[model samples]
Target: MPAPTEMPTKHSTPYPTWEQFQQMEKRQDALEKRQDTTDRRLDSGAGEFAEIKKAQDTLRQQQAAHGQTVAEVREILAELRELVESFGNLKGTIRVMRIAGDVIRWGCTLGAAALGLWVAFRSLGGGL
Candidate 1:
């Protein structure tokens, strides 16, 4: 009779050693530790996200307030422009009045000089 050969069954691993089981358990433990670290990092990220949202809100409010201030400044500039235009018109009117005053003063000076010269000539000619 021939010696019976050991046959591998379809559903069985011939043999898994004790060391292999221990290695698998150690790998599982390491994986669990890595998962815990990842979870902690994700929790910290959520807190950072909340802080970023708060900062964004603060910036939005400041932008809104600045817009209102800009509008007010524009209004003030418009009023200042109108005042400057009025001042220009008033300056032109004052210049016209100054010219009229100078013309009257010169006319009076010439008339007085002419009258004085006529009187001097008449007195000298024996028509005192």
Candidate 2:
């Protein structure tokens, strides 16, 4: 078998010489430091994300409570509507009863007047 002229790599090699290899190492070290910094930032961001999630949950609970309050208000309004209708009906009944009482009072007064007139005519010797 013939000796291969170059080494094979899994990835394309941009650094084929000694100086290029040294430069590649420097770039790799820089990239590793940047990646560490990024990881630290992400760790701190996770705490913020947790707080955001908690706030969202609280907001959802408050919304549900407000919905219950609205439902209760609607129920109260319906009850009030019924009460108002009952009150109006009672007013009409009172008016009818008052008119009937007036009629009865006037009828009694007129009857008493007619009886007194008849008694006076009888005492004056009028026909029975």
Candidate 3:
């Protein structure tokens, strides 16, 4: 009987063709390019986000300033109201003074008329 043919053992390393090696190199280069583009996009987006945050901060500061202005206006209004009230009181005081002056003038006129009548009656020989 013939001896059984032995099957060849499989080789440890498979030889890659030159075309396969070039294809792998190209794929690696494309992957590196994609990564670089992604990094640049992330950097640009971060810069834009920072600008937006700065704008938001500025807006908040402006709002705070506006609030302060409103508060100051309210204080000024209160002061104006106080001044108006004092002015009203002064007007009332002036009105009372005018009335009192009129009363005094009337009293003086009546006293003078009575004195004149008395003097005339004495001159005419009438008893006091």
Candidate 4:
């Protein structure tokens, strides 16, 4: 007969000793602790994922609002461009009117001077 500590021969299967069973129980306890830690991390990760999803939705809404704001800004810019063009045309018309008024004023001044000279000449007996 072989002692319990001796290696098994080819014909017989070996059974675990008391020490080996205790080591296996300790390893099982460590594995269960590691599994519990992993499960806690996974639960926290699920919460983080929900937070990230909420933030993404908020960003999407902000992006849509920004798009609308950009469109409104473009529209305002277009209207401002049209107003600038209209102001340019109005400036030209004002310039033309000012030139016409200057010409008329000068014509009236020259006519008044000529009439004064004619009156002085006729009174001095240099009639035409």
Give me the candidate number with maximum TM-score: 4
Model 4 per-residue lDDT tens digits across residues 5-124: 897775454666677889999999999999999999999999999999999999999999999999999999999999999999999999999999999999999999999999999999
TM-score of each candidate structure, all chains considered together: 0.63, 0.68, 0.65, 0.70
Q: Which ten residues in a row have the lowest lDDT in candidate 2?
A: 7-16
Q: Sorted by lDDT, highest first, which candidate order results? A: 4, 2, 3, 1
Q: Which model is ahead, 1 or 4, in terms of TM-score?
A: 4
Model 1: per-residue Cα lDDT over 1-128, one tens digit each = 22257555544555666887899899999999999999999999999999999999999999999999999999999999999999999999899998988998898889889788888888789464
lDDT of 3 by residue, 1-128 (tens): 22356543443225555777899999999999999999999999999999999999999999999999999999999999999999999999999999999998998899889888999998999996
> Which ten contiguous residues of candidate 3 have the minimum total lDDT?
1-10
lDDT of 4 at 50: 99
Candidate 2 lDDT over 63-109, as tens digits, reads: 99999999999999999999999999999999999999999999989
Clashing pairs in 2: none
Candidate 3: C-alpha lDDT: 0.89
RMSD of 1: 7.3
Clashing pairs in 3: none
How far does residue 105 in candidate 3 sit from its true spot (Å)? 2.6
Relative to the unseen true structure, what is the C-alpha lDDT of residue 103 in candidate 2, on a scale of 0 to 100? Answer: 97
lDDT of 4: 0.93
Preferred candidate (TM-score higher): 1 or 3: 3
Root-mean-square deviation of every model: 7.3, 5.2, 6.6, 5.8
